[model samples]
Target chain A: MNSMKGKPMNHKKFEQMILTPEALTSEEREELARHIATCESCRKLSLQWQKASRMLNKPLPMAAPAPGFSARFAHSIEKRKEAEQQKQVRRFITILLVSLLSAALIFAVTYYSTNSLETIIKDTANASAQMLFLWESLKAIISTVTGFLPTVLLIPFLLTAASAMLTLTLLWLVSIWKLTLQKETVL
Target chain B: MEHELQQWLDEAMQGKEESFCRLVDHYQNGVYNLCYRMLGNRHEAEDAAQESFWRAYRNLHRYDPSRSFQTWLLSIASHYCIDQQRKRRMTLIAIDEPFEETFGSNSPTPEHVYSNNEQSSQMEELINTLKPTDRAALVLRYWHQMSEKEIADTLSLSVSAVKSRLFRARKELAEKMETRREEYELHERETYEPQKI
Candidate 1:
């Protein structure tokens, strides 16, 4: 070992080197060794660290879980799957009930607005025709605007919009799929 | 064994309960040991191991087959234990509790058993003083024999972070050990000096 005769020792640097032995070069390690030989506190720290490292690294027998661990895990998975199916059934029933109540409420409001069932049917048909007419009118306006735009700009614009819509739809589907997976796992 | 494990993994991914249970049986010791070391208690370790398996089962589809299955399983256990440790920060559990229940019945003598338990408890106490991620890093390094890169991947940290954590953890453990030794020596001196007088 090289003696630390002429040089002033930085205990902090040596301590850090001692802590991270793997990070040290061979020369640095030798320097640390020499420092430890002379410095009492550093020597004590080094000894304690070696003891601690040995305790940490000692290979104790692996601790096994209690017997029937696999069986218990299987049972829990079964219980979870059954509970998930029940939850899905409950959610479906709730959605069905809500839809039915909404339909009933709409029927009551429509019947109250139009005294006769025949008038209600006629009014509904008229509203459908009016919506179709408005959709056609909007299409006509879009076609007129498209005609006014240059083809170069129009093609790129349409492509961008289509791609954007497709990307948004994909993102929405992926999020829903992820949420379903997460819910199942959590359950 | 690798081929058999792969076969079981494939079937488990197909949702075969028996295959998954087989996989569980093969890895339960490793998973449980990691949990026990990380959580510093058998009960919590057992629960954490079960939870980790459950998670791995649910996320089987997400598991990349190219990686080592043991590493993936241990990664799950380590993360779960880290979260448990974080939640348990407010509650102080006794880390120095003797693990007599975990000791095998084949020990040679009571003295040997006592020595082992004392050493193991002292080590556990030193390990338990670390922060959760650092503890995970140290456990993976020492107990699981995981490389720094593997520990980084397991803990979702960079290799440098894992290195720093390991270094810091070792320093802290050394300091704690030194303090405990000083206290022990002081106590012995006090008791011995008074008796002599």
Candidate 2:
């Protein structure tokens, strides 16, 4: 019985080593083999591990999917694509309806606030004229500021700024295009 | 075959459905076997394998070509099965039920078939008892023949973690086998001990 129990420390060490025998060094394996010869429980543990490892590691035959698996997958993909198209159509219709509703609400508020169609029309004309005047004034201010710089510096600087803006816009558009493509492809 | 796989992958990435289906045909068995081992049933394995393929199709562009495509596909299946097992933990489903039909049936005799079924069923029971991540690690390591580093990459764990999980999983299986053996021995003793007279 005492022999069966073995030394507690050695038992724990051998037990862990048995659990992961691949990690064992040659000397450790020899030591463990000697220990197992005397220890009943460790011997049983080793045998069990060996049996389980054999069963687990053996290459069982690969299970094949049912026939026409690819055909079924293709059908499902078609269904999913159709569903996605329908979802996109629904979203577009929703957005268009919301925009129309928002425009009608704004018109209604303007009509109520002004109390007359003529007043509303006159207000719209005044707003447009004011925007045009502001634009002209902004152009004049830019010309005044640019009048101070030499033509050589101004030409290159303006060209550089324009090219930078163009690059940024291109980058933004490309990113949006890529994002839309990704959204369409994502499940 | 490698060149053909690469061609199919390129076409699939270009949104060719037929090409993607061809890729599916090539890998169905490998993916299905992984799913069957992880889920432990034919029906769920079928569904899981199909879903994994769908996911791979959707995310095909994100796949890095430098890595092995089989490894990538199996990684997707592993993650899907692990998620399924986690969700299944809440439900009281019997995962240890004997498989209704043997897969890849090429055994020559009834005895071989019966022995295969028994071993397969016992394996399923033992494997189902493991935690989902540990089970994935074990399946990838022993069944798929993935290296420890590959298993680590698949499960997104450290190699040491994979090592420990494999060790822990094997220890649990060994312990379970030991207990079952002892129970069988006890039953046999009770059954044939001269009626305790």
Candidate 3:
């Protein structure tokens, strides 16, 4: 237990010492041998440490990497390199296209912003109106599809409502998606 | 610095398949052995080792050359094992089959070698029951035979902390072994004793 409290030994040197297969220097080894002639506990601990140093002697089974692991690993690395190259090329192309598109967008918006705000609003309003009249559009669709029975007309209105809801939802989702894609302007 | 290694890394980074393959050729076994010791199985160890190398290749540019390359690579594999153990929430893996202790007899064969294996299995089972940290301490100290200072660096603990952890681990293992020995003794006594007539 005192070993627990004691500061770490010259453990850095111990690794080196083990590699040399001699526990101590010539003089130190002679002294240790002399001591071990009489000192029982030190002798035993020394033997134990010496035995532990023979770690590789026990010869833990380490198989060579399975046959053809090298070839397969090489193939996998090639695939990885190919994939990485593709990714880089795609990235460069994307960056190039994006820069071009961004330059075009910047030019268009800068030039057109003053005049286009009104036009943009008008376009949005038209889009929203189409959204707002979804029920009417769906009703037209339903009537076109199921046009015979008066009774069918009543049930057909329910179908129209569902269709209208789905269409509006989809339109709303698409608008959100498009908005996210657009770069934000501080102003 | 091996100029060859540098060339390989440079070419691989430039997306040369041949150079990258050469890199894999160089380090596969070392990675596999480290993983095998930490993971203690073939299939799982192979996967972790393979993943470690791939991760190393993927992040090759980020590698700092100031440190030992093998050490850096091992650090990656070490973290992978830690994350894996955390995910599984177990110190030892659960093989689909019952405990299969593969290896040869220490003593002469057919001299009830199964008994010796049972003893080793019992010890391993007790070790598995220990806290993961404690088990790591025991394994590094006794199994891998790393010095306390070496373990401190490997596990990123202070030397004193490594000592304390190892002491506790040995104490726990000893206690468990004692209990098992007592149980074995009692079982043997019951089985061998003739009923008083």
lDDT of 2 by residue, A1-28 (tens): 3265454445767878998888899999
What is the TM-score of candidate 1? Answer: 0.68
- DockQ leader: 1
Candidate that beats the other on DockQ, 1 or 3, i.e. the better one: 1
Error of 3 at B80 (Å): 0.6
Q: TM-score for model 3?
A: 0.48
Residues B1-197, candidate 3, lDDT per residue (tens digit)? 48998888779778676787677777776666556555556777678877787888788788776755666676677668767767878765543333333344454464545664455445556666666566665555654556777667666679888777765555455445556667878987887786542
Residue A70 in candidate 2 has what lDDT?
A: 82
Against the native chain B, each candidate's TM-score is 0.87, 0.84, 0.62
Residue B59 C-alpha lDDT in model 1: 91
lDDT tens string, model 2, B86-141? 98883223565656553454554878767766676667677878888888888887
What range of 10 consecutive residues in model 1 chain B has the weakest lDDT sum?
B90-99
Residue-level lDDT tens digits of model 3 in A41-125: 4444455445333332343333345656667766576677678766866775576557556654664464355444765676567
lDDT of 1 by residue, A112-145 (tens): 4534566457656875786688669757866887
Q: Which segments of model 1 are wrong by more than 4 Å? A: A1-13, A22-24, A37-41, A86-187, B100-108, B182-197
What TM-score does candidate 2 reach?
A: 0.67
Give the alpha carbon lDDT tens digit for every residue of B1-197 in model 1: 98999999999989898999999999998899999988878788889999999999989999998888889999999989988888877333576555634556775587977666667777777787789899889888887889999999898899999988988888888989978767757877988998888
Collision pairs in model 3: none
**Alpha-carbon deviation at A64 in model 2, angstroms:** 2.2
